[model samples]
Target: MDDKTAELRDIFLDATGGEGTVTERQAERRGSLVDVDDPETVDARLRDLVATMRERYDFATDLETDAYLRLIRGFYGDETDAALADAVGVDAETVAWARLDCHLVRDRDRDDDAPDAIRERAVAADREATRANDRFRDAFVDLLTDADLSGRLTSDSREDGLREATEDIETNVSL
Candidate 1:
């Protein structure tokens, strides 16, 4: 990989709190791998991470949400276009545009309507969340395509499983 690619890979790994190393024997014992090499792999392993972050970390404003996205994206690549798009299902072009919109929206900085700002921020969060979810879906699909898993896991199934996993984590954390 080139320097940029390597950097992006590292960012993604760090964002997901991954150590970026997995042994086959260990995977066999644990039934999972860690520090995935590609977008698909990262998505599969960290499907619940985004939701966990959203639910557990309190964000007071849109700025916080923006910061969260930046942090998550940083874990992938600084470019945003290539790294985020690959991580998510969207094409790099689409991500570029969404990011542009995000920037424009931020630049507008119109908070006169607190209700509107809240609503817009909520929408933005949902958009980012959806993108992250798509990355998980794409990763699962890639796994199925590679015959890494028994059968293709439906998006709904993957989502439900993630939700359950997040709930379990929350329960455990609260204990």
Candidate 2:
């Protein structure tokens, strides 16, 4: 098309000695869109998070994101919080804080009653961590995870989850 392009194409033709079309390549799948249900895929995503967004979320525990993956794995695997704490070398309270920070609420009370609210709690809890208020640190997980097992978080409630989380956090969790 242009002089620079023609020169590069001639160089490519001489080097490769081919008629000219280069094969396109596909990328390895990653990110939220990918369903990480399998164990290997889960580990890859966790490692990627540590590399990319470890600082992005004000995580409560000092454990590496590599270790926190175990916490998340155990959590979704339905492991008890205490057991997860032990696995991740932290106390159970730290486990709860991490869960809330990661937006993995297990509250049964608000499942059906306030489905979208559950997603908002994830955002709010991280903000609360930024405040470093002992009160918020102590109460948020319990407040979010209260009540016996009931329904579950709504699958489609995350469209505007961030804005809702900010408003709800400011309104309800005043220092």
Candidate 3:
């Protein structure tokens, strides 16, 4: 890929926190990819469009949101655009725009032929992160519950306890 393509891909990946692919149906909905001789123009147009879409959809670049998107795509499996949108809590047009973003990222040759394997890896990684977060949250909550700070304690002592508790929990989590 060219420098412009690489940079655009990085931007999309950073914004979405996932390197998803555009399916054939999504490509159809997206109409056509940008066609320009100058990579700079293509990059600028794509960046602006993605920015608008991201803002309009209010897509957060966080693990929880990434997990929800992944789950929606994984479970929907060949479902219609509207169905997927409903499941993911986004409008159908936003769904199309998201696919457009993915298309721009993977359209190195301006063709919608990005491999599904990349998207699969991205989804799996997101799911793994989600699970790890859940485990850490549960462990921390458990520690807080078991501690039961009865009386006022000195700052140093509280800090020490917190450090020790975190170390102990981290040892058990295995993540």
Candidate 4:
């Protein structure tokens, strides 16, 4: 072995008390920081996250914090906005607004009737937010200001424009 290699081996042996054979260390699996599989734990964790989000932002949903979390769970769990509306006895438009407030946007959130400026900006901002793992609501606010439009994201009489495949995904148990 070269002088430098022999020196490193000696240092390694000294540091490891002469057991100098190196074993490959297994890589740790990376994932969510919190355990999310337990329903009760997930429920509590989501509530806390939502509560913190509410304190930081102005939410369009008037639902209580816990109710809002359940609404989000149902949405990510594949329940349509209409079905969630029925469960809450509100219009789907309301549910859509709530969904946007929570940053749970899908491509179908683009509205044909809305002014193209608002529609385009909302879609772009939502997409960028998803890609960056950031808040769509905050980005939408900036985009709306930049476009100089009062963003009426959607109106009454519109339907869910997303395909069924797009509507269903793994339940997002986080805010």
TM-score of each candidate structure, all chains considered together: 0.22, 0.41, 0.21, 0.49
Stretches of candidate 4 off by over 4 Å are 1-35, 113-132, 135-175
lDDT of 4: 0.63
Write down the lDDT that model 2 would get: 0.59
Lowest-sum lDDT 10-residue window in model 1: 100-109
lDDT of 3 at 145: 26
Q: For residues 67-112, could you state the per-residue lDDT of candidate 3 as single tens digits? A: 3333333332445546757766766545544443333122322334
Indicate which candidate wins on TM-score.
4
The TM-score-based order of candidates, best leading, equals 4, 2, 1, 3
Q: What is candidate 2's TM-score against the reference? A: 0.41
Leading candidate by lDDT: 4
How far out, in Å, is residue 34 in model 3? 38
Mark the 10 consecutive residues where model 2 has the least summed lDDT: 142-151
Candidates sorted on lDDT, descending? 4, 2, 1, 3
User: What does candidate 4 score on TM?
Assistant: 0.49
Name every residue pair that clashes in candidate 3: none
Candidate 4 residue-wise lDDT at 93: 74
Clashes of 4: 0
Better of 2 and 3 by lDDT: 2
Off by over 4 Å in 3: 1-64, 71-76, 104-175
- Per-residue accuracy of model 4 over 89-151 as CA lDDT, tens digit each: 788877777676666675666778755644655565475457656853443333223222322
Instruction: Compose the digit string of candidate 2's lDDT tens values, residues 2-76.
Output: 999999989999877775766656677553322433457547756664444455555656777766677666765
